[model samples]
Target: MVKELDEKIGALPDHVGWRLWRASRAWQAEFSAAMRAAGHAWFSEARAGLLGHIPRNGTRQSALIERSATSKQAVQQLLDGLEAEGVLERFPDPRDGRGKLVRYTRKGLDALRDGDRIKLEIERDYIDRIGRERFAALMDALRSLDAGPADASEEASVPE
Candidate 1:
Protein backbone atom coordinates (compact mmCIF):
# COMPACT_ATOMS: atom_id res chain seq x y z
CA MET A 1 0.00 0.00 0.00
CA VAL A 2 2.83 2.36 0.89
CA LYS A 3 4.55 1.42 -2.32
CA GLU A 4 1.37 2.15 -4.21
CA LEU A 5 0.89 5.49 -2.47
CA ASP A 6 4.52 6.35 -3.06
CA GLU A 7 4.17 5.48 -6.73
CA LYS A 8 1.12 7.69 -7.00
CA ILE A 9 2.89 10.64 -5.42
CA GLY A 10 6.19 9.87 -7.12
CA ALA A 11 5.25 12.14 -10.00
CA LEU A 12 6.60 14.91 -7.79
CA PRO A 13 10.35 15.55 -7.83
CA ASP A 14 12.33 13.37 -5.39
CA HIS A 15 13.40 16.35 -3.29
CA VAL A 16 9.80 17.54 -2.95
CA GLY A 17 8.69 14.11 -1.76
CA TRP A 18 11.47 14.00 0.81
CA ARG A 19 10.70 17.51 1.94
CA LEU A 20 7.02 16.65 2.38
CA TRP A 21 7.91 13.64 4.51
CA ARG A 22 10.24 15.70 6.68
CA ALA A 23 7.72 18.51 7.02
CA SER A 24 5.04 16.05 8.15
CA ARG A 25 7.26 14.77 10.95
CA ALA A 26 8.28 18.30 11.93
CA TRP A 27 4.66 19.42 12.19
CA GLN A 28 3.73 16.36 14.24
CA ALA A 29 6.56 17.03 16.67
CA GLU A 30 5.67 20.70 16.86
CA PHE A 31 2.05 19.91 17.78
CA SER A 32 3.16 17.36 20.36
CA ALA A 33 5.42 19.88 22.03
CA ALA A 34 2.73 22.51 21.93
CA MET A 35 0.30 20.15 23.66
CA ARG A 36 2.84 19.36 26.35
CA ALA A 37 3.77 22.98 26.89
CA ALA A 38 0.15 23.95 27.34
CA GLY A 39 0.43 22.30 30.78
CA HIS A 40 -2.73 20.25 30.28
CA ALA A 41 -2.51 17.44 32.82
CA TRP A 42 -4.88 15.27 30.84
CA PHE A 43 -4.29 13.73 27.43
CA SER A 44 -7.94 14.62 26.78
CA GLU A 45 -7.01 18.26 26.53
CA ALA A 46 -4.31 17.30 24.10
CA ARG A 47 -6.91 15.50 22.01
CA ALA A 48 -9.48 18.29 21.77
CA GLY A 49 -10.84 21.47 23.31
CA LEU A 50 -11.62 22.09 26.98
CA LEU A 51 -15.13 20.67 26.69
CA GLY A 52 -13.84 17.94 24.40
CA HIS A 53 -15.23 17.20 20.95
CA ILE A 54 -17.61 14.58 22.30
CA PRO A 55 -21.06 15.61 23.45
CA ARG A 56 -20.98 15.99 27.21
CA ASN A 57 -24.65 15.28 27.88
CA GLY A 58 -24.94 11.86 26.24
CA THR A 59 -21.39 10.48 26.35
CA ARG A 60 -20.02 7.98 28.80
CA GLN A 61 -16.54 7.72 30.22
CA SER A 62 -16.00 4.70 27.97
CA ALA A 63 -16.96 6.81 24.97
CA LEU A 64 -14.50 9.48 25.97
CA ILE A 65 -11.80 6.86 26.42
CA GLU A 66 -12.46 5.45 22.99
CA ARG A 67 -12.70 8.79 21.24
CA SER A 68 -9.65 10.24 22.96
CA ALA A 69 -7.55 7.10 22.30
CA THR A 70 -6.74 6.74 25.97
CA SER A 71 -7.42 3.92 28.39
CA LYS A 72 -10.47 4.21 30.61
CA GLN A 73 -8.29 4.17 33.72
CA ALA A 74 -6.02 6.83 32.28
CA VAL A 75 -8.95 8.99 31.30
CA GLN A 76 -10.47 8.60 34.73
CA GLN A 77 -7.22 9.55 36.37
CA LEU A 78 -6.85 12.60 34.19
CA LEU A 79 -10.44 13.63 34.78
CA ASP A 80 -9.99 13.30 38.50
CA GLY A 81 -6.78 15.27 38.45
CA LEU A 82 -8.24 18.01 36.30
CA GLU A 83 -11.30 18.18 38.53
CA ALA A 84 -9.04 18.59 41.52
CA GLU A 85 -7.26 21.42 39.77
CA GLY A 86 -10.61 23.08 39.04
CA VAL A 87 -9.95 22.89 35.33
CA LEU A 88 -12.94 20.64 34.70
CA GLU A 89 -16.19 20.08 36.49
CA ARG A 90 -18.19 16.90 36.41
CA PHE A 91 -21.90 17.01 36.94
CA PRO A 92 -24.65 14.44 36.99
CA ASP A 93 -25.88 14.03 33.46
CA PRO A 94 -29.34 15.49 33.33
CA ARG A 95 -30.41 12.83 30.92
CA ASP A 96 -28.80 10.02 32.88
CA GLY A 97 -28.36 10.76 36.52
CA ARG A 98 -26.03 7.83 36.96
CA GLY A 99 -23.68 9.13 34.30
CA LYS A 100 -21.39 12.11 34.70
CA LEU A 101 -20.93 14.97 32.30
CA VAL A 102 -17.55 16.66 32.11
CA ARG A 103 -17.05 20.23 30.99
CA TYR A 104 -14.29 22.80 31.26
CA THR A 105 -14.15 25.70 33.65
CA ARG A 106 -12.93 29.13 32.65
CA LYS A 107 -9.42 28.12 33.63
CA GLY A 108 -9.55 25.11 31.32
CA LEU A 109 -10.77 27.25 28.45
CA ASP A 110 -7.92 29.68 29.05
CA ALA A 111 -5.43 26.84 29.03
CA LEU A 112 -6.91 25.52 25.77
CA ARG A 113 -6.63 28.98 24.26
CA ASP A 114 -2.99 29.09 25.30
CA GLY A 115 -2.41 25.75 23.62
CA ASP A 116 -4.08 27.02 20.45
CA ARG A 117 -1.89 30.12 20.54
CA ILE A 118 1.21 27.94 20.80
CA LYS A 119 0.01 25.87 17.85
CA LEU A 120 -0.57 29.04 15.83
CA GLU A 121 2.92 30.23 16.66
CA ILE A 122 4.39 26.91 15.56
CA GLU A 123 2.42 27.11 12.32
CA ARG A 124 3.57 30.69 11.75
CA ASP A 125 7.16 29.62 12.29
CA TYR A 126 6.72 26.85 9.72
CA ILE A 127 5.17 29.25 7.22
CA ASP A 128 8.02 31.69 7.73
CA ARG A 129 10.54 28.89 7.24
CA ILE A 130 8.89 27.41 4.16
CA GLY A 131 7.21 30.54 2.74
CA ARG A 132 3.45 31.10 2.47
CA GLU A 133 2.99 29.59 -0.97
CA ARG A 134 4.62 26.29 -0.03
CA PHE A 135 2.83 26.28 3.31
CA ALA A 136 -0.55 26.86 1.67
CA ALA A 137 0.12 24.10 -0.81
CA LEU A 138 1.12 21.76 1.99
CA MET A 139 -2.06 22.60 3.90
CA ASP A 140 -4.14 21.91 0.84
CA ALA A 141 -2.47 18.57 0.39
CA LEU A 142 -3.07 17.73 4.04
CA ARG A 143 -6.72 18.65 3.78
CA SER A 144 -7.05 16.45 0.74
CA LEU A 145 -5.48 13.57 2.59
CA ASP A 146 -7.67 14.16 5.62
CA ALA A 147 -10.79 14.06 3.47
CA GLY A 148 -9.78 10.68 2.04
CA PRO A 149 -10.83 7.35 3.48
CA ALA A 150 -8.80 5.76 6.24
CA ASP A 151 -6.91 2.68 5.03
CA ALA A 152 -6.28 0.64 8.15
CA SER A 153 -4.24 -2.07 6.45
CA GLU A 154 -2.02 0.51 4.82
CA GLU A 155 -1.62 2.36 8.09
CA ALA A 156 -0.68 -0.88 9.86
CA SER A 157 1.97 -1.62 7.25
CA VAL A 158 3.77 1.66 7.88
CA PRO A 159 6.77 1.38 10.25
CA GLU A 160 6.50 3.71 13.20
Candidate 2:
Protein backbone atom coordinates (compact mmCIF):
# COMPACT_ATOMS: atom_id res chain seq x y z
CA MET A 1 0.00 0.00 0.00
CA VAL A 2 1.17 3.52 -0.62
CA LYS A 3 2.09 5.51 2.46
CA GLU A 4 -0.13 8.38 3.46
CA LEU A 5 1.07 11.62 1.91
CA ASP A 6 2.53 14.34 4.11
CA GLU A 7 -0.41 16.12 5.73
CA LYS A 8 1.04 19.52 4.98
CA ILE A 9 0.52 19.04 1.26
CA GLY A 10 -3.24 18.84 1.70
CA ALA A 11 -3.64 16.43 -1.19
CA LEU A 12 -4.35 12.76 -1.60
CA PRO A 13 -1.50 10.24 -1.54
CA ASP A 14 -1.79 9.95 -5.33
CA HIS A 15 -1.53 13.69 -5.74
CA VAL A 16 -0.90 13.84 -9.48
CA GLY A 17 -3.90 11.69 -10.44
CA TRP A 18 -6.09 13.45 -7.90
CA ARG A 19 -5.08 16.87 -9.17
CA LEU A 20 -5.78 15.87 -12.77
CA TRP A 21 -9.18 14.48 -11.89
CA ARG A 22 -10.05 17.57 -9.86
CA ALA A 23 -9.02 19.92 -12.62
CA SER A 24 -10.91 17.95 -15.27
CA ARG A 25 -14.09 17.96 -13.19
CA ALA A 26 -13.77 21.69 -12.59
CA TRP A 27 -13.31 22.43 -16.27
CA GLN A 28 -16.22 20.19 -17.22
CA ALA A 29 -18.41 21.86 -14.62
CA GLU A 30 -17.63 25.27 -16.00
CA PHE A 31 -18.30 24.12 -19.54
CA SER A 32 -21.58 22.53 -18.54
CA ALA A 33 -22.76 25.70 -16.85
CA ALA A 34 -21.87 27.78 -19.87
CA MET A 35 -23.69 25.33 -22.14
CA ARG A 36 -26.81 25.47 -20.02
CA ALA A 37 -26.74 29.25 -20.11
CA ALA A 38 -26.36 29.13 -23.89
CA GLY A 39 -29.89 27.63 -24.09
CA HIS A 40 -28.96 23.99 -24.47
CA ALA A 41 -31.44 22.72 -21.93
CA TRP A 42 -30.59 19.11 -22.73
CA PHE A 43 -26.97 19.66 -21.84
CA SER A 44 -25.18 17.64 -19.18
CA GLU A 45 -21.47 17.37 -18.61
CA ALA A 46 -21.38 13.81 -19.96
CA ARG A 47 -23.48 14.71 -23.02
CA ALA A 48 -21.41 17.77 -23.72
CA GLY A 49 -18.21 15.76 -23.36
CA LEU A 50 -19.38 13.17 -25.86
CA LEU A 51 -20.55 15.94 -28.18
CA GLY A 52 -17.09 17.48 -28.10
CA HIS A 53 -15.63 14.22 -29.39
CA ILE A 54 -17.88 14.27 -32.47
CA PRO A 55 -16.80 15.99 -35.68
CA ARG A 56 -18.96 18.57 -37.46
CA ASN A 57 -19.26 16.34 -40.48
CA GLY A 58 -20.06 13.37 -38.27
CA THR A 59 -18.43 9.93 -37.87
CA ARG A 60 -19.34 6.31 -37.58
CA GLN A 61 -20.74 5.35 -34.22
CA SER A 62 -17.94 2.84 -33.84
CA ALA A 63 -15.42 5.60 -34.50
CA LEU A 64 -17.07 7.76 -31.89
CA ILE A 65 -16.82 4.92 -29.39
CA GLU A 66 -13.12 4.61 -30.16
CA ARG A 67 -12.48 8.36 -30.07
CA SER A 68 -14.30 8.75 -26.80
CA ALA A 69 -12.31 5.82 -25.36
CA THR A 70 -15.37 4.53 -23.60
CA SER A 71 -17.58 1.48 -23.51
CA LYS A 72 -20.01 0.83 -26.36
CA GLN A 73 -22.95 0.73 -23.98
CA ALA A 74 -22.14 4.10 -22.47
CA VAL A 75 -21.68 5.67 -25.87
CA GLN A 76 -24.89 4.16 -27.17
CA GLN A 77 -26.85 5.37 -24.16
CA LEU A 78 -25.50 8.90 -24.50
CA LEU A 79 -26.29 8.89 -28.20
CA ASP A 80 -29.81 7.68 -27.56
CA GLY A 81 -30.39 10.35 -24.94
CA LEU A 82 -29.08 13.07 -27.20
CA GLU A 83 -31.23 11.76 -30.03
CA ALA A 84 -34.33 11.79 -27.84
CA GLU A 85 -33.53 15.34 -26.82
CA GLY A 86 -33.39 16.30 -30.49
CA VAL A 87 -29.77 17.43 -30.23
CA LEU A 88 -28.46 14.74 -32.57
CA GLU A 89 -29.52 11.89 -34.84
CA ARG A 90 -28.21 8.69 -36.27
CA PHE A 91 -28.08 7.74 -39.94
CA PRO A 92 -26.99 4.80 -42.00
CA ASP A 93 -23.27 4.96 -42.71
CA PRO A 94 -22.79 5.33 -46.46
CA ARG A 95 -19.45 3.62 -46.81
CA ASP A 96 -20.10 0.94 -44.22
CA GLY A 97 -23.60 -0.38 -44.67
CA ARG A 98 -23.36 -2.28 -41.38
CA GLY A 99 -22.41 0.75 -39.29
CA LYS A 100 -24.33 3.86 -38.23
CA LEU A 101 -23.27 7.49 -38.52
CA VAL A 102 -24.18 9.99 -35.86
CA ARG A 103 -24.63 13.66 -36.64
CA TYR A 104 -26.11 16.75 -35.08
CA THR A 105 -29.68 17.59 -36.06
CA ARG A 106 -30.58 20.83 -37.84
CA LYS A 107 -31.65 22.28 -34.50
CA GLY A 108 -28.44 20.94 -33.05
CA LEU A 109 -26.45 22.65 -35.79
CA ASP A 110 -28.14 25.94 -34.92
CA ALA A 111 -27.40 25.45 -31.23
CA LEU A 112 -23.84 24.56 -32.17
CA ARG A 113 -23.34 28.21 -33.10
CA ASP A 114 -24.19 29.14 -29.53
CA GLY A 115 -22.02 26.32 -28.31
CA ASP A 116 -19.10 27.69 -30.30
CA ARG A 117 -19.63 31.14 -28.88
CA ILE A 118 -19.84 29.79 -25.34
CA LYS A 119 -16.65 27.77 -25.78
CA LEU A 120 -14.68 30.88 -26.73
CA GLU A 121 -16.20 32.81 -23.84
CA ILE A 122 -15.29 30.03 -21.44
CA GLU A 123 -11.78 29.76 -22.88
CA ARG A 124 -11.25 33.49 -22.46
CA ASP A 125 -12.47 33.25 -18.88
CA TYR A 126 -10.07 30.38 -18.26
CA ILE A 127 -7.22 32.38 -19.77
CA ASP A 128 -8.08 35.26 -17.49
CA ARG A 129 -8.10 32.94 -14.51
CA ILE A 130 -4.77 31.32 -15.36
CA GLY A 131 -2.88 33.66 -17.65
CA ARG A 132 -2.55 33.07 -21.39
CA GLU A 133 0.90 31.45 -21.22
CA ARG A 134 0.03 29.08 -18.42
CA PHE A 135 -3.23 28.06 -20.09
CA ALA A 136 -1.40 27.53 -23.36
CA ALA A 137 1.22 25.42 -21.59
CA LEU A 138 -1.52 23.39 -19.91
CA MET A 139 -3.21 22.69 -23.25
CA ASP A 140 0.12 21.82 -24.84
CA ALA A 141 0.95 19.46 -22.02
CA LEU A 142 -2.44 17.75 -22.29
CA ARG A 143 -2.09 17.45 -26.05
CA SER A 144 1.31 15.87 -25.61
CA LEU A 145 -0.19 13.34 -23.27
CA ASP A 146 -3.04 12.69 -25.69
CA ALA A 147 -0.89 12.59 -28.79
CA GLY A 148 -0.09 8.90 -28.50
CA PRO A 149 -1.78 5.86 -27.09
CA ALA A 150 0.20 4.26 -24.28
CA ASP A 151 0.09 0.72 -23.02
CA ALA A 152 -0.53 0.06 -19.35
CA SER A 153 2.96 -1.43 -19.00
CA GLU A 154 4.63 1.72 -20.26
CA GLU A 155 5.18 4.34 -17.61
CA ALA A 156 4.72 7.97 -18.68
CA SER A 157 8.10 9.58 -19.35
CA VAL A 158 7.57 12.38 -16.88
CA PRO A 159 10.94 14.12 -16.86
CA GLU A 160 12.42 15.64 -13.77
Candidate 3:
Protein backbone atom coordinates (compact mmCIF):
# COMPACT_ATOMS: atom_id res chain seq x y z
CA MET A 1 0.00 0.00 0.00
CA VAL A 2 2.79 2.41 0.84
CA LYS A 3 4.59 1.64 -2.42
CA GLU A 4 1.36 2.09 -4.40
CA LEU A 5 0.59 5.37 -2.65
CA ASP A 6 4.11 6.62 -3.32
CA GLU A 7 3.87 5.65 -6.97
CA LYS A 8 0.58 7.52 -7.37
CA ILE A 9 1.71 10.63 -5.55
CA GLY A 10 5.20 10.65 -7.10
CA ALA A 11 3.61 10.77 -10.55
CA LEU A 12 1.58 13.88 -9.64
CA PRO A 13 3.93 16.01 -7.58
CA ASP A 14 2.28 19.18 -8.86
CA HIS A 15 -1.34 18.11 -8.46
CA VAL A 16 -3.01 20.94 -6.59
CA GLY A 17 -6.18 18.91 -5.93
CA TRP A 18 -4.41 16.24 -3.89
CA ARG A 19 -2.34 18.77 -2.00
CA LEU A 20 -5.41 20.87 -1.23
CA TRP A 21 -7.25 17.80 0.01
CA ARG A 22 -4.39 17.02 2.40
CA ALA A 23 -4.25 20.63 3.53
CA SER A 24 -7.99 20.67 4.19
CA ARG A 25 -7.69 17.62 6.43
CA ALA A 26 -4.79 19.17 8.31
CA TRP A 27 -6.63 22.45 8.76
CA GLN A 28 -9.73 20.69 10.00
CA ALA A 29 -7.70 18.81 12.59
CA GLU A 30 -6.21 22.07 13.82
CA PHE A 31 -9.59 23.77 13.77
CA SER A 32 -11.07 20.97 15.85
CA ALA A 33 -8.32 21.36 18.43
CA ALA A 34 -8.89 25.10 18.54
CA MET A 35 -12.63 24.66 18.97
CA ARG A 36 -12.09 22.17 21.77
CA ALA A 37 -9.78 24.60 23.51
CA ALA A 38 -12.34 27.34 23.03
CA GLY A 39 -14.84 25.24 25.04
CA HIS A 40 -16.99 24.16 22.12
CA ALA A 41 -16.67 20.46 22.77
CA TRP A 42 -19.69 19.69 20.63
CA PHE A 43 -18.47 21.61 17.64
CA SER A 44 -19.12 19.84 14.37
CA GLU A 45 -17.05 20.90 11.40
CA ALA A 46 -19.73 19.61 9.00
CA ARG A 47 -22.38 21.67 10.75
CA ALA A 48 -20.12 24.72 10.83
CA GLY A 49 -19.36 24.50 7.13
CA LEU A 50 -23.04 24.11 6.31
CA LEU A 51 -24.03 27.02 8.50
CA GLY A 52 -21.31 29.19 6.99
CA HIS A 53 -22.92 28.69 3.63
CA ILE A 54 -26.14 30.21 4.92
CA PRO A 55 -26.75 33.95 4.93
CA ARG A 56 -27.76 35.70 8.14
CA ASN A 57 -31.13 36.91 6.96
CA GLY A 58 -32.31 33.66 5.48
CA THR A 59 -31.93 31.65 2.32
CA ARG A 60 -34.25 29.43 0.37
CA GLN A 61 -33.71 25.71 0.73
CA SER A 62 -32.96 25.41 -2.96
CA ALA A 63 -30.44 28.20 -2.79
CA LEU A 64 -28.73 26.51 0.16
CA ILE A 65 -28.60 23.25 -1.74
CA GLU A 66 -26.91 25.03 -4.62
CA ARG A 67 -24.50 27.01 -2.49
CA SER A 68 -23.55 24.07 -0.32
CA ALA A 69 -23.24 21.78 -3.32
CA THR A 70 -24.81 19.08 -1.15
CA SER A 71 -27.60 16.63 -1.70
CA LYS A 72 -31.07 17.70 -0.59
CA GLN A 73 -31.25 14.94 2.00
CA ALA A 74 -27.85 15.82 3.42
CA VAL A 75 -28.80 19.46 3.80
CA GLN A 76 -32.10 18.53 5.35
CA GLN A 77 -30.36 16.29 7.88
CA LEU A 78 -28.01 19.08 8.90
CA LEU A 79 -30.89 21.54 9.11
CA ASP A 80 -32.83 19.20 11.34
CA GLY A 81 -29.88 18.82 13.69
CA LEU A 82 -29.35 22.58 13.83
CA GLU A 83 -33.02 23.29 14.38
CA ALA A 84 -33.12 20.80 17.21
CA GLU A 85 -30.18 22.58 18.78
CA GLY A 86 -32.04 25.91 18.56
CA VAL A 87 -29.36 27.24 16.24
CA LEU A 88 -31.59 27.55 13.18
CA GLU A 89 -35.21 27.96 12.23
CA ARG A 90 -37.07 27.19 9.05
CA PHE A 91 -40.06 29.17 7.94
CA PRO A 92 -42.16 29.70 4.87
CA ASP A 93 -40.63 32.02 2.35
CA PRO A 94 -42.55 35.28 2.17
CA ARG A 95 -42.03 35.74 -1.52
CA ASP A 96 -42.24 32.11 -2.53
CA GLY A 97 -45.14 30.44 -0.80
CA ARG A 98 -43.96 27.04 -1.89
CA GLY A 99 -40.42 27.33 -0.63
CA LYS A 100 -38.92 27.43 2.87
CA LEU A 101 -36.36 29.86 4.21
CA VAL A 102 -33.73 28.85 6.73
CA ARG A 103 -32.39 31.48 9.10
CA TYR A 104 -30.23 31.58 12.20
CA THR A 105 -31.78 32.24 15.56
CA ARG A 106 -30.24 34.63 18.06
CA LYS A 107 -28.42 31.74 19.67
CA GLY A 108 -27.09 30.73 16.29
CA LEU A 109 -25.88 34.24 15.57
CA ASP A 110 -24.07 34.31 18.91
CA ALA A 111 -22.50 30.97 18.15
CA LEU A 112 -21.41 32.27 14.77
CA ARG A 113 -19.80 35.27 16.41
CA ASP A 114 -17.89 32.99 18.73
CA GLY A 115 -16.89 30.82 15.80
CA ASP A 116 -15.55 33.83 13.96
CA ARG A 117 -13.41 34.77 16.92
CA ILE A 118 -12.06 31.27 17.26
CA LYS A 119 -11.34 31.10 13.56
CA LEU A 120 -9.37 34.34 13.75
CA GLU A 121 -7.30 32.96 16.59
CA ILE A 122 -6.52 29.85 14.60
CA GLU A 123 -5.64 31.96 11.59
CA ARG A 124 -3.24 34.01 13.63
CA ASP A 125 -1.47 30.86 14.76
CA TYR A 126 -1.28 29.71 11.16
CA ILE A 127 0.08 33.05 10.03
CA ASP A 128 2.70 32.95 12.75
CA ARG A 129 3.89 29.52 11.64
CA ILE A 130 3.76 30.23 7.87
CA GLY A 131 4.75 33.91 8.03
CA ARG A 132 2.38 36.75 7.15
CA GLU A 133 3.58 36.96 3.53
CA ARG A 134 3.09 33.26 2.86
CA PHE A 135 -0.27 33.27 4.64
CA ALA A 136 -1.43 36.22 2.56
CA ALA A 137 -0.26 34.50 -0.61
CA LEU A 138 -2.05 31.30 0.44
CA MET A 139 -5.24 33.26 1.01
CA ASP A 140 -4.92 34.93 -2.38
CA ALA A 141 -4.26 31.61 -4.09
CA LEU A 142 -7.26 30.08 -2.32
CA ARG A 143 -9.49 32.93 -3.44
CA SER A 144 -8.32 32.53 -7.01
CA LEU A 145 -8.83 28.77 -6.94
CA ASP A 146 -12.28 29.23 -5.48
CA ALA A 147 -13.22 31.61 -8.26
CA GLY A 148 -13.57 28.95 -10.87
CA PRO A 149 -15.15 29.40 -14.30
CA ALA A 150 -18.07 31.73 -13.83
CA ASP A 151 -20.10 30.23 -16.64
CA ALA A 152 -20.22 27.00 -18.53
CA SER A 153 -18.81 28.70 -21.59
CA GLU A 154 -15.68 29.70 -19.67
CA GLU A 155 -13.14 26.94 -19.18
CA ALA A 156 -10.22 26.70 -16.79
CA SER A 157 -6.83 26.77 -18.52
CA VAL A 158 -4.56 23.91 -17.57
CA PRO A 159 -0.80 23.77 -17.95
CA GLU A 160 0.74 21.17 -20.18
- Candidate 2 lDDT tens digits, 1-160: 2354555556647677788999889878887887787788899988877997888888889999998999999999999999999989998888888999999888788778887787788789889999999999988888777655666345656432
Q: Roughly what TM-score does model 3 have, to 2 decimal places?
A: 0.77
| Residue 136 Cα positional deviation in candidate 1, in Å, after optimal superposition | 0.7
Residue 138, candidate 1: alpha-carbon lDDT: 78
- Model 1 spans > 4 angstroms off: 1-60, 150-160
Kindly give the number of clashing pairs for every candidate: 0, 0, 0
Candidate whose lDDT is highest? 2
Q: Itemize residue pairs with steric clashes in candidate 3.
A: none
Q: 1 or 3: which has the higher TM-score?
A: 3
- Per residue, candidate 3 scores C-alpha lDDT tens digits across 1-160 of 9998997777656688888999898877887677657665656889877987898787898899999999999999999998988889999988989999999898888777777887788789999999999999998888766766556345656331
> What's the lDDT for candidate 3?
0.83
Q: Give lDDT: candidate 3, residue 107.
A: 80
Q: Give the per-residue lDDT digits (tens) of candidate 1, residues 1-160.
A: 9999998886765686698788767766676667666675453434443245445333565567777777777788777877787867778877788878777787777766776687789889979999999989978877656555675444444211
Model 2 per-residue lDDT at 67: 88
- Winning model by TM-score: 3
Model 1: how far residue 13 lies from native, Å? 16
Task: Please report, as a residue range, the 10-residue window in candidate 1 with the lowest summed lDDT.
Answer: 151-160
List clashing residue pairs in candidate 1: none
